[model samples]
Target: MILLKLFWSFFQIGMFSIGGGMAAMPLIQNQVVNLHHWLTLTEFTDLITIAEMTPGPIAINSATFVGIRIAGIPGAIVATIGCIFPSCVIVSLLAWIYFKFKELTVVQGILSGLRPTIVALIASAGLSIFILAVWGEDGFSTNPLTINLVSVLLFTVAIFILRKWKPNPIYVMLGSGIIGGAIYLLI
Candidate 1:
């Protein structure tokens, strides 16, 4: 029953979460954190971080992580399969349709229409992550004491490095982790 529930949850995430992994973050958070109570908000944020740092899609990685946490290896397998199943079917069908209707005005218009929606979804997810990182669980308190200064500093430095040096993201992530670890150790 637990396996079934996990499968269904991820299957829904896969089916409806258009615009890729970043866009899927909210839905994944909803399912795991809000709906199923599988993980806390902090854990969900950590999951996003790990998912971003790892290879492959974030949704699939999240499914596997949640599944394993909930019900071991079998849960992981089922959740992974569930998360992948919709994409496999939908992509195949869409590919065939897209090739056949490559010149259709409606198809082109629909594709164009989706661009802004996708951007909005990505932005929303990014904002959620930013808020969580900078504010912790208290969530955007105006009080100065509530803010996570270390996270803010890390975020600022990361943005600057990304804008200025344009280093590989993996390097930036590693540097941030090292800095965070060193800071925590010192304190």
Candidate 2:
């Protein structure tokens, strides 16, 4: 029964999350934190960290983690089904029409408009993550010095490297995990 519920929950998320992983964050947060009582806000934020350090889409990684955490392996399977069902249905329907209309001028114009909106959505998600990561559980920036100079430097360096080098995202995730772990140990 719980498994069914988990699967259904994820299916809903996948089905309705129009803009992909980033857009799903708010929905996931609402379910995990407010609706289901599966995890607290702090836990939800932490899960984002785990998702980033894992190798997959944020939505999928989050569903898997929350599902497993809530009800072990069975829960994980359920949640994954839920998360994927929406995408599968939507993609199949879209695919049927996509090829036919892809060359149309109106379709092209719509896509061009959508690109910026998608980018804005992604940027908003990033800001949310930044708030969660730096502000901690109380949602207050708890940095002793008001700002972490090292992190800023690292961020600039990372941006520079990424701009100049088309490195695989997985490699970047791994490197970030290592650096985060190192920083944890150091501080």
Candidate 3:
């Protein structure tokens, strides 16, 4: 039952999410957080951190992680299939007709326009994660008027510095993790 549930949940995600990886975050969050109650917001953040650090699509990694959490090895199998099946089918079909239809103006136009939508979806997903990271601590009392403002300011400053200096994303993520850890300890 758990395996079936995992499969169905991820299949729905893979089927509906029109863009790749980051574009899938919102729906994945909704299913795992709101629908299934598989993990809390804090847990989702942790899983996302691992997903970002690992190879493979974020959505697939998330599905496997959540499935394993639910029902171990079998759950993982189901989730891997759920995440992959749609792409396998779609790509196979497209491959058969892609050459013949490659010059179709409508198809070309649709693909071109999809780029912006994909970017927008990924940006919105990032914002959602940022919101979660700011205030997802359970039972930790934070003064919204003071601490929240500090956090927001720090986040803005970090982004500004990152953009200006242009360092490796890995280093930035590691730095953020260290800072988050220190803040948690302090609070």
From the highest lDDT down, the ranking of the candidates is: 1, 3, 2
TM-score order, best first, reads 1, 3, 2
Global lDDT of each candidate? 0.93, 0.78, 0.81
Per-model TM values vs. the true structure: 0.97, 0.75, 0.86
Model 2 spans > 4 angstroms off: 103-106, 140-153, 164-173
Model 2: how far residue 4 lies from native, Å: 4.3
Candidate 2 vs candidate 3, TM-score winner: 3
Regions of candidate 1 where Cα sits further than 4 Å from its true position: none
Candidate No. with top TM-score? 1
Between the candidate structures 1 and 3, which one is better when assessed by TM-score?
1
lDDT of 1 by residue, 14-106 (tens): 998899999999899899999989999999999998888888899999999999999999999999999999999999999999999989999
Per-residue CA lDDT of model 3 for 1-187, tens digit only, reads 8788899999988887778888988888889987999998878878888888889888899988998899898898898799889878887887877777988898788889988988898898888776665654442345574335545656886788789999987787688778867876988
lDDT leader: 1
Q: Give the 10-residue window scoring lowest on summed lDDT in candidate 1.
A: 133-142
Model 1: how far residue 32 lies from native, Å = 0.3
Lowest lDDT sum, 10 consecutive residues, model 2, at 131-140
Distance from true location, Cα of 183 in model 3, Å? 3.0
lDDT comparing candidate 2 with the true structure: 0.78
